[model samples]
Target chain A: MNSRLIIANIIRWLILLLFQILILRNMSFYNMATPFVYVLFLLLLPFGIPNILLYLIAFGTGLTLDSFYDTLGVHTSACVALAFVRILFISVTVRDGSDEPEPTLGNMGFKWFLLYAVLCIFSHHITLFFLETFRLTEINYTLLRCALSSILTLFVVILIEFVFYNRKVR
Target chain B: MRNLWIFISRYNAFFFFIIFFTAGIILTVRNNIYQRSVTFNSTNQVVGDVYKNLNVLKKYINLGAVNDSLAAENAKLKTEILSIKNIDTTKETVVKDSAGIPQYTYLPARVIKNSITNRNNFITINKGKADGLSAGMPVISPIKGVVGYIQDVSEHLATIRSLLHKETYISVSIKKNNAVGSLIWGEGNFDYRKAQIKDIPNHFKLSLKDTVITSGFSSFPQGVLVGTVSNTGISAGENFKTIEINLFNDFSTLQYVYVIKDKYAQEQKELEAKLTNEQ
Candidate 1:
């Protein structure tokens, strides 16, 4: 909520959105395992950010991606769901009204961050792939996409954090 | 009232989440093309401009190869045009200008972004309204048969709802017998290669490698190769048989597609609308 934080987030948003839309948007491995690194923006949002603001930011981020992908509402819904789960997971694990540090790998340690990312990424991917497919008959295929994409996204997100944020934090 | 207000305020985040979630569902279910066109689709100026720049750079890098291919395609198209220029003069129902020239025109465009992984995949091309492209115009790959319909257009960019999309259904037929069926892509990109053709008659006796092409009954021109019949199933108790086709367009690496401009489309659409309204 400081000027520097706002500036940093705006820059982060632009970089992540560009990378996601331009690079990863078309990077699918045999129709499976598309890495959506933009979710890292939502994942790294500071812990003490207001819940309503988090939801709005998530919606905004997802909606921006929705337009580019031409999958209206699919990403929007997934981002909102991810935001909800992020809030829930943080509340359950972290203390109420704690310091507003971001839940990054460097700050929260590797193990804790991975679990948090798994839950939120799965939530978003499941909501996303299912909404995009919108059918029960292809549940298996949808589930496979969710699992594969979530794993890929998780890997990319972690790698990005290690490369980008580790040096900054140190 | 005070207690109720407190409880609601306590769960305000949940309420907001519900509002956004419902909005997303509405968009997903309705697949609101008009709404998206007016708003955030890449067709919009900002996103379109960015994509245009990125594509320019990518095209710049691939310019040498593209030039060679363009020359090859140019020679091929010129020859093809020469062959098709002399369509039988006696052919009835062909749309012609006052000077007897065919009305359908083809505009080549480069694909800036293509998605084969998503269930509702779309391809964005470098041409848009400025290039005389519009919604409902048929897009076909130069090598592959049908690509998709123009879903939205901006000044410099347009998004195509490709054959890989779940909502895109194309009317097609078996080339051998002209038996028609509907082609749809909802089987989860089994390999980003397969699509299902529904409503084929059980007695059609569809064999493997039976060529599937655009059924002229629809907006797309007739006899355009859709794919070859790869799999056929005769399920029990069902009057209609379903078959799977391997799409000719390798969406995984789709680079260029042509948007077909049919001069009679407006006239045909209006006439059909009138007929439907009357019925």
Candidate 2:
């Protein structure tokens, strides 16, 4: 709600979007593992942010990436779904009495963060790959892509957190 | 009214989610090669500019490989010209009418964007209406093999529905037996190296390495190389044989293509339409 927090969020948004489109867009490992580190922005958003704003931000992020990927609406739909269900993830991972402002590895323990990140990334990848292929005959291939991409994305997300935010504390 | 307002405000997030989710699905499913929505595809001005710049960088890195391919293509063309001269001396001319005019003209274009991973893959080229390119014109690779047909054209850009697209069905004939069938790219064909040919009767004697070529029944011209048979099988309870062919063109690394402009296409189309209407 503060001006400083809003400014920080805008800066984070721009940085993640640039890194995603410029760097990670063409970086695929062995033609299977594509790291989608932009989801880290959604994961780190403040828990107190309004659900409506969260969904809008998710839609905007996904649409921008979709334009770059030439995948019309697949990314947007998957991102919206992830953002909509993110509150459920936070409720399960965060203790009821805890007053964590933002969901970060430093604020939330590593174990909680891992579980949350895995769930979010898995859901996003599954929805995205399936929707992109959109055929029952290729279900196995779609599932394989989802699993591999989720792992790669999670690895990159954790690496970014450690390298950038490890020194900061709640 | 107060209670209804409270209910609406309470579930506003869910409502917004539904709205956006439906919109996304509509955008994803409704788009095709012919009618691309301008808002979120790479062909739009903003995304196209970014990709154009990126392609320039990639072009520099692949300069050596591209030069090698061009040299190979030149050698192939020289040999083809020599063989054609020999054929002209020994065999009768089969492709000429009384006027002796050629039926097709080729226009060269560079592929700016292409994809083989999606369910319905498309290729974007630098030529469009300004270069005399139009929809339904067949595109071939540098080696004179089938690539795709143009589906949409803008002022300076065009989109092609490649063979890897799930809905693409090409009329092809096996060279050895002259058995005609429809070639298609089925689901889960992620490799982009092969396609499936269906509806050939089992009675035909098919063998390994049989060549497939365009039958000239559709947009593409006759005798353009399609692929070679890699596998063959029979479907359950069906009298037709299923054939797998290794395509001649490596679609993954395609950089240049030629769009064939048929001078008589409009005339042929109108005559065919007239016949159908009379019947």
Candidate number achieving the greatest DockQ relative to the actual structure: 1
DockQ of 1: 0.29
Local accuracy of candidate 2 as per-residue lDDT tens digits, A22-88 = 9999898787788889999998898888888898889989999888988888899899878866867
Question: Considering every candidate listed, which one attains the maximal TM-score?
Answer: 2
> Candidate 1 lDDT, tens digit per residue, B194-255?
89998888777788998999997777888787899898776667888788988887787667
- For each candidate, the alpha-carbon lDDT, in order, equals 0.85, 0.84
Candidate 1 chain B weakest ten by summed lDDT: B34-43
Please tell me the interface RMSD, in Å, for model 1: 4.5
- Say which docking band candidate 2 falls in: acceptable
Interface RMSD of each: 4.5, 4.0
TM-score of each: 0.49, 0.51
